[model samples]
Target: MIETLTRIPVAHYSNLKARAGYSIKIDKTEIALFKVTNGEVYALENRSPHPKGGVLSEGLVSGNYVYCPVYDWKISLVDGTVQAPDEGKVQTYQVEIKENIIFIVL
Candidate 1:
């Protein structure tokens, strides 16, 4: 079966500051949105991949990686991969900006 992707409008581009993390919920899924300094917006599962599970939205954003607040695991926002020395990965969603509105593809 083919899966259909939906574009869910979350927020405006101007509302998100550069190099900051914003949290949004779609149905039961919690997503963390990050607007990088380069004007790129990335979407990732709000939950950390660590066994303890930290909140990615509360994590610090440095470049394209987010440091898990609980375990300090550096997770790549681009592909949702946990950095080396850490194991596991989070779910990443595609993001698009149209007319200053941010939409997350799910």
Candidate 2:
């Protein structure tokens, strides 16, 4: 079956910087947008799997992973997978940047 996606504009490219991320709410879900060190952007669920808190947007971003601020769980920004040595995962959203505008596929 084919999946239908809704692309929603979240922010402008200039508002996001390298190695940092921003959090926004979509209905009841908290979405985090990150501009990785490689100049590419990624989107993930803002909640950390360690039960620490929903602070993935404020976590320490190093390369492709963001270390949870409360419990130090390393989460991969590329796919929202909790790094090995840890057990859970968050949701990864498909992202598109067109003409410097960021859009998240839902």
Candidate 3:
């Protein structure tokens, strides 16, 4: 069966700074939203994938990757894959922007 996607409006594009992280919640899921310098937006699970989980929203954003603030594990915001030497993955959400409003697909 095909899964249905729901688009939920979360924040305004103008309110999100480039290369920064914004935290949001959908139901029980906590998401970290990142706006890259290139004007692309990505959404990932707020929690890191390391054994000792860190908050992805508090991580450093460089290019399309975020370094887990706690363990310094590099995670890809585009696909939520933990970088080499690290063995794990976070959850990623589809993001859409329309008329400056950011929507997360779930």
Candidate 4:
């Protein structure tokens, strides 16, 4: 059965990394949070869509996309859509920022 997701506050700009990863709790779920841009945080499934690898929180950001470190696959930072060659899309979470604090809706 599909379960409902919960939104949880993750961090602030002082604690967030530029295109890095951090974990947060959302309805008892251990979520992987990514701070992709300033004032624009992108949330995605911790697991990568291409093969079985990490979701690439540390993946290189070129333009508006990130490249998965595993197979060098580029995933869209804005929507988590699989870019080009890659197939399937990873889950994406709604992100909102307030007072420099990052909030994510899993």
Q: Compute the lDDT for candidate 3.
A: 0.94
Question: Taking the tens digit of each residue's C-alpha lDDT, what string does model 2 give over 1-106?
Answer: 9989999999998889888879988888899889987789999988898856658999989999998988899999987788889889999999999998999999
Residue runs of model 3 more than 4 Å from their true location after superposition: none
Summing lDDT over every window of 10 consecutive residues in candidate 4, give the lowest-scoring window.
30-39
Candidate 4, residue 80: lDDT: 79
Best by lDDT: 3
RMSD of each: 1.1, 1.3, 0.9, 3.7
Quick one: best TM-score, which candidate?
3
Give one digit per residue, the lDDT tens place, for model 3 in 8-63.
99999999999889999999999999999999999999998877789999989999
Off by over 4 Å in 1: 1-3
Per-prediction backbone clash count: 0, 0, 0, 0
lDDT measured at residue 82 in model 1 versus the true structure, 0 to 100: 93
lDDT of 1 at 30: 97
Candidate 2 all-Cα RMSD: 1.3
Candidate 1, residues 1-106: lDDT per residue as tens digits? 9999999899999999987889999999999999988999999999998877899998899999999989999999899999989889999999999999999987
For candidate 3, the TM-score is 0.96
Candidate 1 least-lDDT 10 residues: 49-58
Q: How accurate is candidate 4 locally (lDDT)?
A: 0.70
| lDDT (Cα, 0-100) at 21 in candidate 3 | 90
Better structure of 1 and 4 per TM-score: 1
